[model samples]
Target: MVGSGFQRLRKSPWEILSSAIFSSILVVSSQLALAMVPHFFPSFSLVSMLPIAGVVFVATVVIGRWCRRLLGVPASAPAFVLFNVFFLWGVYICIIRQAVPSLLDAILNAECALLLFGLYRIFSSDPGMVSYDSSRSTEASCNGFSDFSQCENSSLFPRVRYCTSCKTNIRGFDHHCPALGNCIGQKNHRLFMVLLTGFVIAESSYTMCSTRYITRFLNTSRVGLEANLSLNMVISTMLFSILQVLWQVVFLMWHLYCICFNIKTEEWINWRKYPEFQLNIPAPAQQGSAFSEIRFFNPYDKGFVGNIKEFLKPKH
Candidate 1:
């Protein structure tokens, strides 16, 4: 069942072609920009790279739109390409240009590789998909609540949700990540967290390194800095890195909080719907009220240490 579901996730020919085209443009454009830097700037200022970057950006946008509208490629796939583009630019223009220590460069590259691997694993691995078992009655699957059988999605087991996007029931369902092009659930949740944490660290470091580069090498004079394209390019990278770091950090923190309490994001958002939550919370509950005196009771929460243990424990 998992295999069949995974097979469904496979990309169409058009999608593969679209990805190849997108990647090719990014690689060729960046390399062309780098090549032009030596001849145009002589001293190799980042200013020379901007024109190509703009062109590449426009080209990718057009291709993305065309692919989505015509070939029907998933919009989320472009995010992976965008990430690589940023990482490549950061490494080449900032770290290399600034001549950061080899140790730092190696570390950054290693993190990038690991992040790519983690993403691949998340994309390819099953996220604890729950297969339908006709032999098991709704009473058994729904914890003796046969009434739940009347529900449209009665086949789902406890804590399992039907993902419309993936067309499968995800066990310990968290949320569907369009960017990852997969559902995050029991199996891949750990990998998702690791990837998020790594990206937050890597992007933050990239921002720092780029800032250091601008400060160290660029002219400090007000006039010199004013309208400086090279400075602008580096600054743009810094801003991009900062933006990524900000969102990822916030997202990571939220996930960490949920993990500490042994709750899934889906459950956190839709707690009232679950009988466990309704039973735990006192009577006369205001529906969908954000503020309540009664603390949410999570049956799965086994204290901080225990929750962490549960999260980290290997899954079969």
Candidate 2:
């Protein structure tokens, strides 16, 4: 079943009993952690956890709603709460209690929550879907369409191609993210970029805060509960921080380059694979020449400042 992820009881009864025993042992070990090693540093209060906890709950609920609509799967809510919100919350809690000061964690996580809400905006909005007639008119020149083809509509919408997967014409269609269960398109591309930027900022803060604790625990001469817990939290948070920071930084840079050129990932890929592919809006049909002559040059190139303005400005 789709949501019945782990219901199978295939383990033998002996295996089950052994697993239970082992779990009990692990629990006892964890409880004894502070006792066995008094030097270990982390001490938490419900107060510290509260702010981040509230953020996590709000993120889970908001993203759950947006993600379900994007993916068209209402049944994913349980997993969304379990993995996206609480799982991350658990990791975050480790950092708040063991690695970073609670006040700092709360501040950083609040910013992270705002970014998540921005991402939810991207996920929930349409990706600038163009009408079929609008796309079809690209063959002719009319109004601002300088391309050879005639354009009957002067309303001037982005020239879009048909998307077989979506069964619609999409303006500036990027590609479908299976994880998001939605296509990245013109409308939300900028917001998506900002979301990635947010993750980078948040993860960087987490890694930095974790580093001091990790250094102290690793350097300690004595081995005890605090060292072990600190080690676990530091290692876990740092690995992801390194990965996310690198990936998001690179991804954001590449996308910015694309934005400067007014292209999407899908368009870039197509242009690379196919020699005849065009990168910009259709060229003016001109007094004589067809729009195809300068294939690499972007028709939408409004210089860096203009592009930035258009990109940052909100659209209806």
Judged by TM-score, which candidate is best? Answer: 1
Model 1, 1-316: lDDT tens digits are 1232322356778766766566555444444444333344535344544454455445655655675567554444535554554555554554445546677767777766777777778777788875544445543555543233224455345677656677666777899887777889889899889888988877776766676666765455434533254555555455445545766888998999999999998888877666565443434555766553545567787999999999999975
Give per-residue lDDT, candidate 2, residue 148.
16
Per-model TM-score, in order, reads 0.70, 0.57
TM-score for candidate 2: 0.57
lDDT, candidate 2, at 205: 78
User: What ranges in model 1 sit over 4 Å off?
Assistant: 1-8, 19-74, 78-98, 134-156, 219-230, 280-296
Superposition error at 123 for model 1 (Å): 1.7
Judge candidate 1 at residue 280 and give its lDDT: 39
